[model samples]
Structures are given as C-alpha cells and as structure tokens.
Target: MRPQHRVSARIYSVSLRCAASLALALLVSLGCSDEARPKAGAYCKISEEGQASACLAPAQHAYPAFFRGLAQDKLSDEQAREVETDIAQGAQSERSYEALSTLAYGYYRLARAASSQGTADPETLARLEHWNELLSKAYASSEKDPRYREALRQAAVDVGSRTPPLGLRCTDADGKPARCDSTEAVVRAMDEARDQTGVRGEIGRLFDRVFGTRP
Candidate 1:
C-alpha cells in the first residue's frame, strides 16, 4: 500500500475503534439508568397490545403537556381547567398515586400563580384547599413506593421555598375562608401527611395491596 493510503487506513481503523468504545459505554450507561429507575406498577402500565383505559390515557398523554404548559406560562385558564377535569376524572376512577400527585401539583401551581399576582381569588382559595386534600391522598396512596414518596417530598420542598401571598386564604372545614398565610404551614402539613402512620397509613397500604396499583 502507498504511505498515504496506509496512513488513511490506520486513521479509519482508529476512528472505528473509538466509535465502538463510545457506543459500548453509552449502552452500559443506559443499562445502569434503566436498572436504577423505579418499576412501573400495574396502574401505570399500558398493555403490550397498546391498550389503555380511559382513566390511564389522560395520565399518559395529557399530564406532561399540561405541566409543561404551566412551566412555560402558556396554558390558558380554560386549558388548565380542561386538563384538571381530565386528571380529576382519571384519579377518581383509577386512584393511581401518580395521577393523584400530578393533579395535586397542578393545583399547587395554579394556587401559586394566583398568589403571585398578589390577590387570592375565591377560585384560587378553593383550589388551594383541594391541593392540600389531594396531597394527603397522594402521599397516602404512595404506600411503600419510594419513587412516589420522593416525588411528593421534592414537590413540597420546591413549592414551600416560595413565599406565599400576604393574604393567601384557604377554606376551613366549615367552608369559610381562613388565612393560610405561609408556605411554611403548607410544607409542614405536607410533611406530616407524607409521614403519616397509624390507621390512615395502614388503610392506604391495604388499599394498595388490594388494587395492586403503584405510582
């Protein structure tokens, strides 16, 4: 072979080896990540035949888009309400912890946005109360699932870091508006709910065992 051709062949061989090494590394990295990821439970899984229930479809398709819209501030009130209705319907039927948590977080985002505007409307206050109720339900439904618990905890921390509006209000048990007033109070409630034990926790575990659902 000519010297130039020999040199070119050697360079090509080196490039091929480097490419192979990188591909191998990438595969190994991906394998590790997959192993580390939490396994999807029955409620969160689509059948191999690509079938999904009405309750599961919105969670798979609309939940992520809705949250993305919230992050980008591109979601209109009507769109948000529509997504909320879809998720709420799914949560009612499926009782999936993931769906419950997603719905709770959406409410929190809406409440935060309304609070940030410096005035808490009646609708916003209602949503805030619903958010708390949903948070409790989500945490309870998580059962022994570490992934669900972690997601709830992280969301609480993220929202709790923000200062609440000075006049933030939430409905009391009597359906009267009461000053909630602080993010700290909200986070404290979330923490307590997440760590709840005794009858409530036992009931949640029993429900999960019966339904075979995971977030």
Candidate 2:
C-alpha cells in the first residue's frame, strides 16, 4: 500500500470556501452548452469545443455540493464515499489544470480531517500519505503554470495548512540520497523527471522521478 498509487475511480469530494466556489463557477463558465455529463472514462477526452466542457461541468459543480454536504453532516458515510469516487475519477479523467487543482484541494481537506481525528491507524496513515501524494501530483502537474499552481496552493492554504509534507525521499542526479524536506523541495524533485515535450507526460514523469520506476 504505497501512497502514490492512483486510486481506482473508486474514491473523493470538496468544500464551499470562497475560493472553491469561485473555481467551481469559473469551470462552469467555460462551457456554454447544456450537454450531458461524461461518464467516468470520457470526462477528460478532448472533444470538439462545447462537448468536452459540457461533459465535465457536472463534475465541477458536484465537487462543491459534495463538500457542503459533508460539512453539514447531511451526507452519510456511503454517500460520501460514492461522491469521492466520482471526484477522484473525474479529476483523473480530465487531467485539466483545474481538475488537478480541485483534486489537490480535496485531498488537502481529507488530510485535515484525518489529522483532526487524533489517532493514526494504518488506514489513517495510508490516507495521510495518499493525500500527500495527490497534492504533490497536483503541484507538479501545474508547475509551469503559476496561476494554476498558486490558485491550488492558496486553496490549500485557506484550509489552514501552509503546505503538504509529502514525505518524499530524494536523490541527487548522481544517485546519492537527497532530502526533500519541504513542499517546494518535493515538487522540485518531481520536476526532475518532467517531460516538457508533452502535457500528458507530467504525472507519469512525476511518478518516475519521485517514486522510482514502480510509482
């Protein structure tokens, strides 16, 4: 149970902070069409204009709603799990800057919840580690885009934690062990294996760089 493995499209949700609400609105505004939402597999596939955005719009809207539900205690554990799974799948399926940032912030909230629980069982520790990995991926994915990165960072900051400690161990170029003690250091390490040639390669490269070949 390594933390960095991508969860099956089977887990996550979000909050109603001003920033999250604004982000949800912005993503919604990206489309003018009222087309149906995409299923788990189709959400991120680029389509002609309005089609893709339309498909993703529901997921965007759902993130905040799910958050509000959780915060208000209106959602049961099973309901929360289902929404989280949709969110996790939606974020990965889209791989858009906004989607990834949303995922990062969602995980940040989950981590905060886990922290407030005041106990660390195996499940809790695993969740905390996974939360760290997701946050790192979100940051690494958005590295070249300061606007996106900063937006996500502020969202996490608004959650009251300055940065996520990813618990990554690094190595210098020569293969000697290195230390990534801060969020910046972890992201920089992820940047090491980033393939600037293509957008889709970022996550894969990040896994290679930080977690070795296995991810």
Which candidate has the top score in TM-score?
1
Per-residue lDDT tens digits for candidate 1, residues 104-143, read: 4454456567766777666656655555555545555554
Clashing pairs in 1: none
lDDT of each: 0.52, 0.43
Give the clash count for each candidate.
Answer: 0, 4
lDDT of 1: 0.52
Poorly placed runs, candidate 2 (over 4 Å): 1-60, 64-92, 95-98, 134-186, 195-215
- What's the distance in Å from true for residue 50, model 2? 33
RMSD of each: 16.2, 22.1
For each candidate in turn, the TM-score is 0.42, 0.35
Please identify model 1 stretches exceeding 4 Å from their true place.
Answer: 1-61, 64-116, 166-178, 182-186, 193-215
Mind giving the per-residue lDDT tens digits that candidate 2 earns over 66-177?
4554354233344345443433442333443445433444444454454455543455345434444554565555544433343334333333233234433444456676
Error of 2 at 197 (Å): 11
